[model samples]
Every structure is written in structure tokens, then in C-alpha cells.
Target: MSTPLKPLPAWADVALIPLINVAAAFVISGFVVLAIGENPLEAVQILITGALGDLEGIGFTLYYATSFIFTGLAVAICFHAGLFNIGVEGQAYIAGLGAALAALYLGFLPGYSLVFVAIVAAALFGAAFAFIPGYLQAKRDSHIVITTIMFNYIASAIMGYLLVNVLRVPGQMNPETPGFPWNGRVPQFHEVLAKIGVHWPVTPFNLSFLLALLAALAVWLVIWRTRLGYEIRTVGANPTAAIYGGISPARITIVTTLLSGALAGGMAVNVILGEEHRLILEYTAGFGFVGIAVALMGRAHPVGIILAAILFGMLYQGGAELAFEKPKISRDMIVVIQGLVVLFAGALEHMFRKPVATLLARRTTQPPI
Candidate 1:
């Protein structure tokens, strides 16, 4: 039998490895760029400039990051429970319905009060939708991956039916709800800054960015500092051991999945209430799928998630600029870049770990065994 590889230090495992993976992914992406007769260096400069060169760029990057952060945290929560919940896309979709309904039907409530209700309704909707798969996984020994995949199609069909037959405004061809009341919106970032006499450029960013940060802090506290968190980690590490330690794996599975789905719902509040201020069929725009990569790249940690989200936000904003400036590079090429990152970060994540650990082990004093 092959000898087991040496273990890495905590810093190396959590921070160093992920950074190297991202860098490697980028380097590979550069080669892909070169294949298309584009200057990789110029592309890198353009990406950096477009993502952070001005207030407009920064605002748009953060707006994208806000949605990513919510979805990343949702995936992270499920990761810690040893559950790969891929149904967040559907959960977030249903969540938009809840947020839209609250804003549309609850127009009688006070301004931000209705916003709060929409947020709660969003969480409830997401959680309720997720409960079905969670229930099956816990009780019926069903595979979460399969069920969640099926639910994604189900969600899209349901949303299509509802948007066309029920929510679409009369005499309009678009399948979307009427514009929400002005007060129902979460305050826009530029408007809020303008209120304080700071002239910031207009972007899709809004108060929901602050909420995303708060959610990250809350996830950290809940995951690392609480008894429930300990139980979750314990269960994830080894469900058999957790059962022996008086923790019910079934209960943890249900609760963790619920929390995951709720966080997924928060993405809707960021996009629908904070940005669009209207319910659109394509509002989600694949952010749920992006969250999986964010979670993986982040190593299922809040700090990592924030950084990863921002990096993806940069890619999104910068990629748009890239497509605009370079006729040779299409939007589909940008997706290839993102896919490379995901490939390095997920399936091929451990490709370098053994080599890295071997190197580190050789360098350590008195390490050879």
C-alpha cells in the first residue's frame, strides 16, 4: 500500500492552497486567451482596470458580489453538514416569488416594514421549498443530488407557468410582475450616499450589500461559535460518531438544509428588492450555480467566501468590459475563464495537495520519517 501523504499546516490548507489554485486557473486561462491571438497580459490589465478603475465599476462589482455572498454562504452551510445541496437555484427562484408577492400584495404596510416582511417571506419560501428534498434525504435514503437536480427543472417550469398565467401584467408580452411600489425597494446605494452629500455613481448596488456582509458575520458566529455549529461539524465529520455523541444526524441534516435554503433566498432580496425593484423571470441569471464554485473556492469559510465572491464579481464586471473592448473575445469566452476557475477549485482541487505537502514536509526540520 502507498504511504499516506503528510498533512499541511492550517494556513497552507485553508489559504495557501486555494490561492495557488486560483492562480493556476488564471495562468491556464491566459494560455487559452493566447490561443485566440489575444495578448494575455493586456487582457489581465483590462480585467483589473474594468473591475476596479472607477466608482461605477466598484459599485457594479459589489452589486454582483452581494448576490454571490448570499449564495456562497448557503452552499457553505450545506457543505458543513456533509450535504451537497444543488437545489439552491430553485430555492432562490421561489424566493423571488415570495419577495415579489410581499412587495406587491403588502402595499398597505409601512415603507421599509414591508421590505422586512418581504425578506422574511423570501426565507420562508426558500426553506419550504428545500424542505421536500431535505425530508427525502433524511427519511427515505434518497440521494440529494438527484432530487435537487430534478427540483431545478421543476422550479423553472413552475416559475414559467406562474409568470405567464398569473403574474404577468395584462397586455404585456413580457412574463414578469408589475413594478413594485417605490417604498418597497431596499434603498439604493447611490441614492443613500447622495442623501449624505456624497456623489457616488449610479449602479445596481444597494443596501443589500450591507446585509450580505452582516449575513457573513452571522454565518461565522453560527458555524464556529455555537453549540449547534459544533453539532453540525461533528455530524459532517462523521455521522456515526455524531450519533454516538447524542446528536441526531437526521435533525442536523434537516436544520442545516433549511438554513442553507434560507440563505439562498437572501439572494433574491439582493437582486429583486434591492436592484430590479421588480420581479423578472430571468432575475437570478445563474448566480445560484456560481455560488457552488464560490463555496468550493472559499473552502466553505465566510472570509474565503467574501473574497471569492468579490473575485467572481470582478470577473463578471471585467468580463463584460472585455467583451466590449475586444471583438475577438465573446461572452462565451468569459464563461470559459469562470469554468476554468471552477474546474481548478472543485474537481481538481486536490491535484496539487500531495505535491505541496511533500514539499512542505521535506523542508520541515526533522520531518522525514
Candidate 2:
């Protein structure tokens, strides 16, 4: 007979298990590093130093984390509603077009005004791009996963055309738009710091990082403190029961996905306004997909997502530093490490679940003296 397992404690389910899994992943990764003729302990030190040793490294790490925060929250919201938004990558990409248009046309406006309008444009465009797939799923019963995955390729092609044919800078070989006006640029965080007499190394970290924090706060409020959130969660928990209670699953699905897409679109602001200062092809650089891992590792919670995003961000910046410092460790090796992290944190999450549950069950059933 199968053992009747008790649910894990909150601490174990949320904190302890994830920590153990991450540690296990790193342990395995250390073995791989050793096999490659490198000292895993030294490599770990290099990663920490590279990502957190200086302001410049911290800046880049935070910059990347900002994007991951947007995308992670996007995916988390959709996941909560029983949807898998694989098209966040594409939504973010297409949203850049809207942001670029606002920058180009409203360059005459003051800095704050231009930024505000661009934010609205990006969110609208991203939501609109995601709506078709969402609609197909809700109305026609199309599988959301397949539709969203296909949409990613469509978004890529559309972006390629727009960049090369329409938005290309005059007399420039690169398929990027002309730079945004001075007033249109989002001020970098280092510049703000310098103004306050807190000098730091120049980096792409910008005001958008604050925006990401705000987004996370907003997501928490919406998910835990609002009526619409209740409906979305209800539908996810039990669709037929939600219908019996007069909630429309179709409407909730569409609205939830649109909100998710808009959140994902906000990521473009960090890249285009904060860093690149103009629209560029493939600026997202697969961060959309990485958001999936972030959301999974974070347990689909905003706080967890932020922590996971930072960890991945450290991996990214630190990996670059490691590659530069030790040429023997190729960039591909860093990707392998990241992949292993995702694999353990997500796909193999239940590997220790039964064992932990069994141990807890035994403890709970122990005979008292």
C-alpha cells in the first residue's frame, strides 16, 4: 500500500526545499567544473566578486534583474490564472516598437512627460500583441501554450521587418532607430547618485529599477488584496465552481493575460530608455524565457520572484566576469550552469518532495512518552 503523505510545512514547502534544491544544483555544477580542470570553490569566489565586488558589477546585476522582475511577474500572474504565457518574449519585443514611436515623436516633450507617454504606449502595444492568442484560447479552445510559442516567432519576424525596413537609422548599418532625444532619455541611476554626491561607476542601472520594484508591489496588491484577483484565483482553482458562482472564465482569462502582457512590456523601458536609449533588435536576449525559471524558482510570488531574479542576475553578470577572467571557462559553460539551476528548481522539483513528506509524516506520528 502507498504511504499516506502529509502536506509539507510552509517553511519546508517554500523555503527549505528550494534552498536545498539550489544547493544540490550548485554541488553538481561544482563537479562539472572540477571535471573541466577548474576549482569550483575558486570559481564561486570569482562569481561573487564579479557580481558584487564593485558598484559597476552591482549596477549591471541590478539592471538585468530589473528586466527579469518584469518578465517574472508577468509569467507569475499568468501562471496563477492557470495559464502559461510563453509569448512574454515576443510581447516584450513588440512593445519596444511602441516605446520607440513615442520617443521619436514626443522627443519635443519634457523628460517626465515623454517617459510617461512611452510607458503607456509600451503597455498598450504589448497587451494588444498578446490579445489575439489569448482570445483564440478563450473563445476557440486553442491551446495557449502552442499559440503563445508560435507568437514568439511571429513577433521576432515582425520586429526584424520593422527594424530593418522602417526604423533603421539613416546612413547607419545597424538596424536600430536614431537615438532618443536628451529629454527622452531615462536618467541612469549612477547619474542620480552622483547628483547626491554619491559617486559610483557608470552603468546602465536606471530609474526603471525603481519602476520594477513598484511593479512587484503592484502585483502583490492585485493578487492578494483585490476582488478581481479573487476571481482569477477562483477560476484557476476550480473553473466549474467559478462558473457556478457567476464568474466568467473567458473574461478573466483575457483580462489576466492582457495584464500579464502589459507587465512584460514594461521591461522594454529598462532596456531601450535606461540602457540602449533607442530601439534595437533582439534587445530582450531571451530574458523572456528566463522569466519562466524565475517564476518557478520563486514559487510564483512577487517576493520570491525578486529574490530569484537577483540570483539569476548575479549568475549572468558573474558568468560574464568569470569568462573574462578565466578564458578556459567558455560562455557556454555558464549557460550550462544556469540550465542546471532551472532544471533542478523547476523540472525536478519533486525529486525530494516524497522523501521530505515521508520524514515529516514519521515525525508527526511519533508516539509520545
Candidate 3:
């Protein structure tokens, strides 16, 4: 005999489900910690402290969070449009080329002006990378998933070729471009904090984190307050009905995907402009792939995505600390934990759905006395 399930409230659907999923993942991860002769509770404390114990840790956590925020928003936007865009990794990779090109050629401009041009270049290149797959899906009835995945490989290959042949710095064996001029370098977080008479630890965090916040606000406004957003949602909800209502699904798909790619490209601001100050091979470092997990855990909302990105940043920074503090726990162990999180939050999301629904159904059906 099974209890019937009911739909959860909006708040529960958005907040509770993901929380439950994350809790379950952590519980399972606890066992792995215990198996390695470490106390799970102690491990949890270490993770929290290592990620947020001091200004330095906090800065690094936020540094990682900035990238996740950009990629998460990119994924969330595409999800809203009923599109599965998996090319963010490749898009960011390709966008780095454009950013590097801008830095190389526009070094003569003032720092602020050069930064603006570099940002536009990255967005344009990323959008152009995604445009072909989007066009194919919209006009040629091609599967977006396949085309986007293939594009990732193509982008990677192109990047490799350019790095090795065209952009490789002379006398530098590594496959990378020369460092951008100091004038083009973005200010670091500590420098900004100093301006306000606030002492802060040295870390890789920078102004790009603030840009991520602005992007989130912009996304919220675009998705909820604009006419174009309404048309996008309409087409995503029901394509045939949208067509009847004079909304073109194909056009919306292409536009949404281009927007998604541009957002992903903007991640280079944190990497190229803020931290590296140069273009390097594989600079994206899997942030784009992790974004899918962030979007899933966030339920594809901008606010939710920001929270989820912070959580992932904690995982990344804390996981590194764990590896250092306890030699018994290797980096691969942290990866396992991350994998479990994504597994429960995304691939196995329904594991708790029926049970939650049943509980909600019971609550709603009880007699009011």
C-alpha cells in the first residue's frame, strides 16, 4: 500500500527539492569520508572552515563563484527557452581567443576602454560559435544536442591549432599567448577593497564578481519584465500555440542560444582579465560543464543559480583544502563527492519526487478541525 502524492508548493518545489537532494548527497559522501578513517562531522567542519574561515579563503571561494555564476546563468537562460545548450565549455574556450586578440591589438587604449572592447569581442565570438548550431536547429530541423556537442570538439580543435601555430608567443614553448600589457589588466579585489580603506587578504577575486551580480540582475529583468522574454517563454511552453499566436519558435531559439553563448563567453572576464591577464590553453577548466549541475540544482532561476553557484564554489575551494589537510583524501575523492551531487541533483532528480509528493498529498488531504 502506497500513499498518494501531491504537487508541492512553488517554494517547496524550488527550495526544498534541491535542498533534500543535496542533503542526501552529503549523507552518502559522509560514508566515504568515514571509510577513509576520517570523521565525517570533522570533515564537514574542515570544509566549511577551509572555504570561509578567513578573508583569503572567502576571496578564493568567491573567485571560483564568479565563473560559476556566469556559466550557471548561461545554462539557466537556455533551459528557460526549452533548449539544452552543452557547448558553453567550447564557447568559453573560443571566446578566450577573441579576448586575447583584443588585449593584444588594443593594448594602446586606456584600460577602461580596452576592457569594454575586450568584453564585446568575447561576447561576439561566443555568440558566433553558438550561432551555427542554433541556426541548424532552427532552420534545418537538426538536433541541438548533437550539433552543440559536436561544436565543442570543433572549437577545441580550432583553439589548439591557433594556440600552437598562430598565437604562440615566440620563444615560449608552452601553447599560450604572451601576457597582456599591465595597462589592460583589471584591478584585483584587494586593490579595490583598499580604495575604500578596507583591508583584505590577497586573493584572485576581482571586479568581475561584481559584473556577475549585474549580469544576474539584467537576466532577471530580461526574463520577467520584457515583452521579448514573454514571447520566448510562450514559444518554449508550446511551440504550435506560439506559432498560432505569431511567435516564431525558430527565431526565439536562435536568439536565446546566442544570448546563452554570450553569457558563457563573458566568463573570460574573470579568467583572462582578472586572474591570468593572458590567454592560455584550457582556461575554462570545466567551469562550463559544472554549470549544468549548477543550473539543475538552481531550478533554472537567476536567484537560485547564484545560490547554487556559491555552493559549488564552496565545494571546489573546500575540496582543495581537504586534499591538502588530509593526505588520505585525494582530489579524486572530492570529485566523487561532486559527482554524487550532480547525480542526485540532475540525473536522478526524481528519486525523491514521489516520496515528497506523497507527503504533500497527505498534508493537503487531512481534515481541518
Candidate 4:
């Protein structure tokens, strides 16, 4: 009698799944473009050209990509630790307020460097806002998803009230805080580059791009090379197993969630400090939700997250242009594409697993001649 062989693990084929999903997404998006009576090839050409055809386009893509990187990393970290941090949006909003206040109130501190104070203030605010949900989850054993969602609503209402009343800039009807001083603004280099015919490829792309790259690298290093990362992974994989191995899953959860919030908070600096230099109502603009998709698409890997972020950023910038150039094609079409991509990607994990397992089982159980 022959012994039964074990099947290969599903994760062994994880690499191919994302690729297949991406290809399918593109095909579906093409169909969508056709359904709207637009030439798929022309639509794709417009997208590529708008995203990367010139220096300005490239800059905008990179600028958006930088913000996505920060938020995406935040989502990725929480996901890796088996926690869902839906509070990134609210945390980022509160952090922006803190940054604006710091710039307005703390701007007069003699000898205090602008960059140092703004960054510290934003990070602290972000950490504090995020820590609330983390504490609740740890102490009360509450569901993070519910707590975070509640916090989002609370933060939005609070921010709206503050922007309209307390933080409102004098003489401006807009519900926004006063713009940051010269010291708080991120330096613009594209103008100088353009004068020399260099045209830096985008208006918004700047040093923040490098900062995002470093952040992604740091996340990868922390998750793959450090002891704390091991604890996080172990805890995520199995709380019971992690507890048996002497790791405190509760502590890991708090730490990971805090780190995730901090990352999201950092995105405010990129926006308020780097580009906008003001706390506007629409400052975050759904980046948090988009980050969730990015995290899922990347499978929680930092490099993959970066790639996914860039792709989404490109789509966002390009889709806007597509709408403008082709009045018949709505920008919402891009949203449909993104939705399809995420839906397929989500299903792919399970779709690939069942078939591969059945095939491996059949292969292992087959009789020999």
C-alpha cells in the first residue's frame, strides 16, 4: 500500500495570484471603457499620457503617490498585525489640525525650528488620536473596527466645528485654518527646474518622494529583519500559538496599531507641510480608504504597497484628465475600475487556494502504474 502524500501549501503560489488579478482588472477596465463608447486604446493612451507624458503630470503622480505611501503603510502595518485600523482618516484629520495650530500658535517660539516643531506636533497628535482606539481595544476588548469607525465620525464633526469656529481664518469664508507661514511651507523646486527646460515632470513631486521611499524601505526592514516584527507576525498568525511562545498578543496589537496610526499621521505632514501648508476640510480626501485597497492589493508587503499606491495615484491623476478631455466619459468610470480591481483581488486569494489544493491533493493521491 502506498502512503498518502500531503498537499503543497497555498501560499507557495501567492506570487502568481496578484499577477493574474492585475491582468484581469486591466481587461475589465478596457471593457468598461468600450461600454462607454470610447476607444479602449485611446483611453489607455490618455491615461498614460496624463500620468507620465510630461514633467507636470509625473510630478502630480508622484505627489499623490507620496501621500498614498504613508497611508498605505499605515494600513499595511495594522493588517499585518491582524488588526483593522479604520481610524487613519480621522487620525490624519486631527493631526492636520494639530499641525495647523502648531504652525499658527507655536510659530512665534524664538529659535524653534519650523520643520522640527511641526513634525513633532503632527506626530504626537496622530499618535494620541490613534492611541485612543488602541487603548479601548486593549483594555475593554472592544472591536477595533467599530471603535475606529465611531472615532472617524467624531473626528470629522469636531474638525468641522473647529474649522468653522475656532480655527477659521479671519476674513475668509472657507472653513479652513489660516495658511502656514513661510517657514512651514515645503520648498518648491519644479519652478526652478522648469526655467532651465528641465521640467521636473510634475508640479507636486518633490523631496517627499524620497521620504516615501525611505518609509517603505524602513517598513520592509522592520517587518522582515527585526525581533519586534517577528513578534508581530507570530501574534498575527496565531494568538494562542504566540501566547504559548511567551509573546503577549495584546501588547503587540497595541504597538502595531499605534505604529499604524503614526504612519497615517505622517501623511498630514506631507500634505500640510509639504504641499498645502494649511488644514483644509478636504485635506485627506479619501486617502485612508484608498490606502485600504493599496494594502490589500500589495498583500501587506511594503514594496508591493508602494507599487500599488503608484498605480492608484496614476489612475487618479489620469482619470481626472480623461474626464476633462473626454466629456462623454465620466471620471466615475475610474472608480468602477478600481472597485473591480479590488473585488477581483479579494476573491483571488480564495479562488487560487481551493483549486491549487484540490489539484495538489489529486496529484498526490493518484495511483502509480
- Assess every candidate by TM-score: 0.96, 0.96, 0.95, 0.89
Q: For candidate 4, lDDT tens digit of each residue in 160-255? A: 999998888788999988778877655555755667887454365656677778878988898889999999898888989999999988888888
**lDDT, candidate 2, 1-369, per-residue tens:** 986788899879888778878888899989999999999999999998999999999999999999999999999999888899999999999888888899899877865799888888888988998898889989999988999999999999999998999999878899999998876777898899889999979999999888999999999999899999899889888999999999998999999889988998878989987889899989999999999999999898898899989999999999999999888788999999999989999999889888888888888899998
Provide the lowest-lDDT 10-residue window in model 3.
Answer: 2-11
What are the clashing pairs of model 3? 5-357, 5-358
Among all windows of 10 consecutive residues in model 1, the one with the lowest summed lDDT is 360-369
Ranking the candidates on lDDT from highest down gives: 1, 2, 3, 4
Q: Go through the candidates in order and give each one's C-alpha lDDT.
A: 0.92, 0.91, 0.88, 0.80
Candidate 3: where are CA atoms >4 Å away?
1-6, 360-369
Clashes of each: 0, 0, 2, 5
**Which wins on TM-score, candidate 2 or candidate 4?**
2
TM-score of 3: 0.95
Q: How accurate is candidate 2 locally (lDDT)?
A: 0.91
Tell me the deviation in Å of residue 1 in model 3: 12
Of 1 and 3, the candidate ahead on TM-score is: 1
